[model samples]
Target: MKVGTKEAAELLRICTQRVRQLLKEGRIKGAEKGDRFWEIPLFDGKPEVKEGRRGPKPNWKKRVSKAISRICVNQHLIRSNSKHGTNKPVIRVESRGIIRYFHSLEINGSCKVVYRPDKPLSCGAKLWLEVASDVMLTAFVYS
Candidate 1:
């Protein structure tokens, strides 16, 4: 029996989206277009997935990143240093139908709170960044 693209992807040990790409490129054998979907013929072995740039690759060796964030109602260019244990930004990707961006300030090992009249540590607000989509930055958020 023929299967849909999603089922074919499962049998092939690949993603459904990639299966669709393969279908578009005419790479899948015994693949036919149905009224509602593409009917793919399932075989005994795994199908060959296309080789291309699936996504962006980030450089992990570099750690120092710069970001413009609003702290205490003022915008300052924040330079994040991974060497520092405290005040490092942590990004979390939520597992769901759509990818979610969640950011928080983290302090590891030791933390010290200093009170100053001119500048505060908490900043009395959440961190907001201003940067381009192509740029990558690890912001040091102060909470």
Candidate 2:
């Protein structure tokens, strides 16, 4: 059976723009039926949704690296030897495994550290560390 873009969007639980995007990306099969109208075919098989399929599944190490990069970009890092004194650095942790993981490095003049809990931590947890006055860092460690 053929369905319009609105029907397709409703069935897919996504915005119509997303439906059009999928069509443009060639992830879903559809055809232009008329002026400003498109038809999507109904299939018995499961809908094949593509998410990050162009590359390999991100490894844990790679995820941690990317998370750390994000944190560095978001926060300032205070170094160990700032004359004004140090502030507690903020640690953001995310995990995909049972064992805890730690990714540590010094950025700017501060020590930026990430710690993943052995078990998944609560969605929001506040942790502390020491850093310079001008530099603050956020660290995220994921399993």
Candidate 3:
């Protein structure tokens, strides 16, 4: 007795595509390619499925380690800068990406800072603006 790929798939409890793949891979015997379908021997047992390596590949660890190292280096630079003083440039231009420049400002005087970009920011920009300012005791007493 012979059955088409669809009927074979139903008997094997798998998809028709898998049945066709098994036939092509010669996992099952007596499978003849018909006009538009495959004729598989109904007497043959279900083909065995070999277990393959699952989940993400092992090479991801190397890439992840590189990323973590980069982050650590950036953190070290920030810590060293803070210990020395805020002498670093407030704005730094990059060669690529949407954020053309990186801006980090620190104000320690009785003044206000404003950021007015020429074009509207679409993404990759974080604006940390505080509207309210605390008045010092001396400034309030003098006023």
Which regions of candidate 1 fall more than 4 Å away from where they truly are? 45-143
Specify the poorest-scoring 10-residue window by lDDT in model 2.
Answer: 61-70
Best by lDDT: 1
lDDT per residue (tens digit) for residues 16-38 in model 2? 89778777777775455567777
RMSD of 1: 16.8
Q: Per-residue lDDT of 63-128 in model 3, one digit per residue for the tens? A: 211110000013344576699975433332221121222334333334333343653233322332
Which 10-residue window of candidate 3 scores lowest in summed lDDT? 64-73
Each prediction's TM-score versus the true structure = 0.32, 0.31, 0.30
Per-candidate clashes, comma-separated? 0, 11, 0
Q: After aligning candidate 2 to the native by TM-score, how far in Å is the CA of 96 from where it should be?
A: 35
How many clashing pairs does model 1 include?
A: 0
The number of residue pairs in model 3 that clash at the backbone is: 0
Ranking by lDDT: 1, 2, 3
lDDT of 3 at 6: 72
